[model samples]
Target: MSSAPALADDCRFDDRAGLLAMSPEAFDNGPDEGWDALAERAGCQLEIAELFTAYRQQAKAAGHAGLAWHEATMRADAGQRDPAIALMRLTYKPHGADPEGWNHYVDATIAFLDDDLPALKRARARLAKLPMPLGNAREQGDDERPAGRPQLKIVDALIRCMYQPYALASESCPEP
Candidate 1:
């Protein structure tokens, strides 16, 4: 059996200190800065991946499944889909509650594939166990629960930005 990865020495900041030092602006900041810093400080992508893996493991062991899911999603969005999907599948059973969320997850995943219709269709069919959200509610509004989470909306926007295709400019380059 394969062992889980280890956290990088440099990326192993004390949670208490990090939280105490975190600014309001930092919360709104993109992960690129921090993730890049981690990669540079650790001196390798393997170490950075290990650090995130350890963090996810700790979150899962602590029963903070939502946090684990969030981390997994972030990693996936950053191009680590296999591990991310594995972690997500572990956190919540496929076809369990929150079908809408699962469908979105599958759709986002298929969007990342290299336009393989057979694979895409298979994934869509497998994810059919989950219901799609009505009228893109996942993107348009915040989830109105006691939790009041905005992460879902953020994920939707990220997926759209990441996977949606764009047209190329014409060679003539004439202004429309």
Candidate 2:
């Protein structure tokens, strides 16, 4: 069996302490490669994956999609097949007919996990085609991206992390 990839000393996704010390913007602006490296590093921590799964079960029981998604991501980082498939399905399962921008986001996430560069690009283009938030209003320090667009930022961060490794490092934050 293949072993997990080695991580640099500064990679913050290795444990709760590092994760806590990190800022949210890191995931937003950090190098795409860093996200990838984190995921690769996660593969070596099966114990952490199990904990994530337990947390996912709790989140699901509480009907918290956001928390479930986060835990699912941790599981996915450990190369858990169920979480990867479930993550895509959960994102795609909601919203029938006109899926708004979710289709792009879901597609982008799947492509990222699959390492399909072309598909990821196409999905990102589709997402970009959607109207961006109006005006350059002052940024809020809140956890969410904005109203009516829950989890978009998280999805983008996950996508960036899944595809590349060891890019210019930036800040990140705990999932709110």
Candidate 3:
């Protein structure tokens, strides 16, 4: 797969004011053209991939869950499900008494992949009951708090809910 783009040598969104002024709309305006320009200006897949991965990891650590997820999701290989599934599993693992949000994530992922109305409906129902703090924060444009009680609880719950479904699905469909 092609790696993410690198920033231009003269790109000047280095400060807070510059960042704030940089609208998300700009990114959305012409992604392919922008990426092509960036690729042309900064030539090196390794450098671009490293920069993209670093940004994604930093976003995750900084509670910018939406950005982190978006980065991962966008780069997911079309024929590869393992990485996506692994990510879902990691996000929902439980820590203590609480259930993580793994279940909701898994359900959502399955719904996204399957395109089955029944599965989608079931996933949506389960999702409605889950706290889904990270999902909620992303929707509200609020940064997720560092991993803690609420995060753990949601993660655990998600894990529990998704476990059986994931297992069953995997069993039914072996990877080639």
Candidate 4:
């Protein structure tokens, strides 16, 4: 399993513009160790769904719902289902920290995953009302942070991989 790339010597998180200025490739190629192995183990959609369901359940049982659910979404992204569905699930998490417009986003994701394109389209219409920065923002800290949301970029890369898996081999964003 390969690790996430180390920041280039020239890069610095402290500088908002510089951080945002860095090319998407810089962050897209982060570590995704063992994802291929995990995916291979779960060959079909049913296997992947079962695996993710168990993982989500366990995460909730152990009281790590927020992070665990996020991780499960990532796993779903790596599984046999449509990559777009996986990407949507991760990006459209509902009932978490900020549930404001997440319900529609989640509805769209489920509809997409279930192969109900019409439902997904309708749900997406509702999701259009949300604010610009898609997905839940990582909790901000007292210290300064980057201007761009790298995590959202991560989601973008995942969506790309769904349609072009081999081209972005190490670009998958597995849970840390």
Best by lDDT: 2
Order the candidates by TM-score, highest first — what do you get?
Answer: 2, 1, 4, 3
lDDT of 3 by residue, 6-34 (tens): 45544322342332233343322346422
* Local accuracy by lDDT, each model: 0.42, 0.48, 0.40, 0.41
- Regions of candidate 1 where Cα sits further than 4 Å from its true position: 1-52, 59-62, 94-96, 107-176
Evaluated at residue 141, the lDDT of candidate 2 is 44
For candidate 1, the per-residue lDDT at 81 reads 56
Write model 1 residue lDDT over 104-150, tens digit each, in one string: 44453444433344454455445444444455554556565322123
Model 4: number of clashes? 2
Better of 1 and 4 by lDDT: 1
In model 4, which residue pairs have backbone atoms overlapping below 3 Å?
A: 3-31, 4-31
lDDT of 4 by residue, 1-176 (tens): 12222234322223434422433333222243212223333223233334334444432334333333334444444443455354345544445555345657456445544656677566655555445463333344324545334433443333333333321422453443
- Writing each residue's lDDT as its tens digit, candidate 2 over 61-108 gives 344344344444554555654666575566454555434676677676
Predicted structure 3, TM vs. truth: 0.33
Give the better candidate number (2 or 4) by lDDT. Answer: 2
List candidate 2 segments past 4 Å from native. 1-45, 96-103, 134-176
